[model samples]
Target: MSEQKKAEKIVGVKGMNDILPADAPLWELFENTVHSVLKSYGFQQIRTPIVEPTALFARGLGAVTDIVEKEMYSFTDSMNGDQLTLRPENTAGVVRAALEHNLTYDGPKRLWYVGPMFRHERPQRGRYRQFHQVGAEAVGFTGPDVDAELIMMCQRLWDDLGLSDIRLELNSIGNAEERNKHRVDLIAYFEQHKELLDTDAQRRLHANPLRILDTKNPTMQEMVNAAPKLLDYLGEESRAHFEGVQKILNHNNIPFTINPRLVRGMDYYNRTVFEWVTDQLGSQGTVCGGGRYDPLIEMFGGKPTPACGFAMGVERILELMKASGEQYAPNQCDVYVVHQGEAAQLQSFVLAERLRTAGLDVVLHCASANGGGSFKAQMKRADGSGAAFAVIIGEDEVTANTAVVKHLRAEEGAEQNQVSVEFDAVVDYVVDQIVGHGHDHDHDHDHVHYHP
Candidate 1:
């Protein structure tokens, strides 16, 4: 085959990845943790379409934002000439759904989403073009307590993940008019120091000078210190709201740093913005980050509703957990029924189903050429699967209406204590053996025998 054809057949597209089954347990752990936390907090799941009308995001996320300007995977639809884009974030689409479905008609809604986001960018460690996010949003509440609750939920998620060394950075972007005044002030400040600004900063200085404060250019960084502060320009209401937020956070004993320069990239955000940064993963810092986009609902043509939300990057969190030696134990399969022949395969299936109905996970041996790989290989696969015990069924055991249940992690060259149990008693016997005792399967073996 030609190189191009070979490449097309073998490799995933750039900036995309196939999450292999080996990593699935980690994803499940994080996903389940998020669901548990959200459920305890009374957040309902709201799924939005992956592709949406281009105008929805263009208007809601702001046209000049980086997500709209550079990162969006936008294309014209072949069926309907309507321009469409794969969602880069959930908020805009969620807000659009709330408007179209008239969800805001009744009252405030606490909503969340967990799914993929598409962004065309240089893929790196813990970052992918198509990545998963677990996010929550509270619509129609402007109180600081709502903000504090969101922050607390984020902390809860981090705690559940067992992530350490995380820092909370909070900021207020102020109300619209105050923010407008600060924008003009920033433009004037950067214009005076234009000579020191880098090309990007110089360009942003005129267009959106507050973005200059976010620039990483050393010269711009120095200018940022002297740049205008949003706090000084905060209107009376904005100031009081900010103070209320601080008070609530203090009441909850949540530590945070006020970053005056922390302007969210989206135009809809106002009043509060925060980020959860960690030092665990090298270079890639933010594991979770989001802010209150109070004006987004109205901006999307819904009745005015205040909303706050945050999205946790699952891949980033997993990477950090792995780096910190936080192990997510693999999913436990209750029984691994090894079949010696086609007849045994049928018998194993029946036994596996019985275990399944009893609320247990079971994996059956499907190897056609059974003797090619040794019992050791079978045991390794069973152990790696985190199965409770190995059910070794051969012609002898099947004919006798019983099977040998071997301890999967018995010491090498040591005799495995096999329990001969009637076929009907197998499920109960295995459950008693696995869950009743602290059995160690020694899953940390260096060699991996991949089995499904």
Candidate 2:
């Protein structure tokens, strides 16, 4: 016999994590909360392609920014020789879509997105190469009212998610003209302390001197702190715009601190930059970051338009949610249908479909190596499925056209509390019990429970 070649296992790419079943409950909780919170703020969802032109980011995010220079996953397509990149951040892609489709032609539009973004970075807690972001962009809005509204919306989400200790820090980088003047002093100041500037800082000295102020190099901290604060250079109009956002936030009782060193990774952000930071998550403490990018639409070949948005890291927030000590059950389905015998198997399928038709999640058990597993074995699988109810059918029940409903989540050591119902009445009986149980827990505090 010829030698057989062995097959080797191929694993997922590093830093691209799989959302295993065990962790899915927490992810579902976070996503559902986000959808509800965004909808409350009148923001509608917008989805864009994962791949966009390489030049879009090069021109939009500034070629010198770390995201464009080091982090972006860009390549030239072999098929058509078109330069493409998996988006590192979604703001640019969102703006490109809006411009291409004239989405804002009618008037201003509020859009939101939730999807994965690609970035090549050392993976660690709360960060990955393939990470998900839930962002909201208010396009064509020209005032600080929207700015404050977006921040308030974030606070509402944190509150709803039972998160605490995440604080907001704000600053204004000023308009292009104002930033130019600050850039001048920032370069000169860093030039004096050239020895203190790291290799990255030295390279960015003239090209992007402002970003050095955001450096985490401990050696350069003292010098960078003394570098010109952008807030000191804000023009009267920029100052007024920043104050307007603050006035609204203060009135709404959203507390924040002014961090002069707070700067965004992108060059597009002009004024009113802010970050929601936390003591947790180690060095990657920024849970969310965003700012007003008034000039971006014009830069994208659209008319002069004002826009502001924010994106929160889904993994990071989930980590915080875990720390909050909330528990979640991995509910695969609401009802698990277990059957034995040929006739019971067919009847189980029919009953499952009917339950689903009534808007209930149902799981129908199938025979394994042990054909028509004893009722004992099938019931074990049902208990492990995280199902609240189990519909048991055997040859006897098939003959009688009845199903035994077993309460799966009943109190510890409590009776199974099995109920026998006709096949025609199974759907109504299951739904009434589920719905009535919810009402008792939510409203009827004095409701009595039936025990064996």
lDDT of each: 0.80, 0.88
Cα misplacement distance, residue 292 of candidate 1 (Å): 2.2
lDDT of 2 at 362: 80
TM-score of 1: 0.90
Model 1 has an lDDT value of 0.80
Tens-digit per-residue lDDT, 1-452, candidate 1: 55555444577898888888778888887788889999999999999999998888889877777788899999998987989999998888888888888886788889999999999988998889999888888888878878889899988888887876888998888888988898887788777877898877766666666677777666557668988898899888878887888898898888999988777777788988888988776667887888888888777666678888888888888887787786666667757777676667677888878766665667876665655345567666777777767887778877998878877655678654677889888877766665556554333222222222
List candidate 1 segments past 4 Å from native.
Answer: 1-8, 368-380, 410-416, 438-452
Q: Write the per-residue lDDT of candidate 2 for residues 372-424, one digit (tens) a residue.
A: 47788788889888778999999899899899998888877776478899988
Best by TM-score: 2
TM, every model: 0.90, 0.94
C-alpha-based local distance difference test score of model 2:
0.88
- CA shift at 339, candidate 1, in angstroms? 2.3
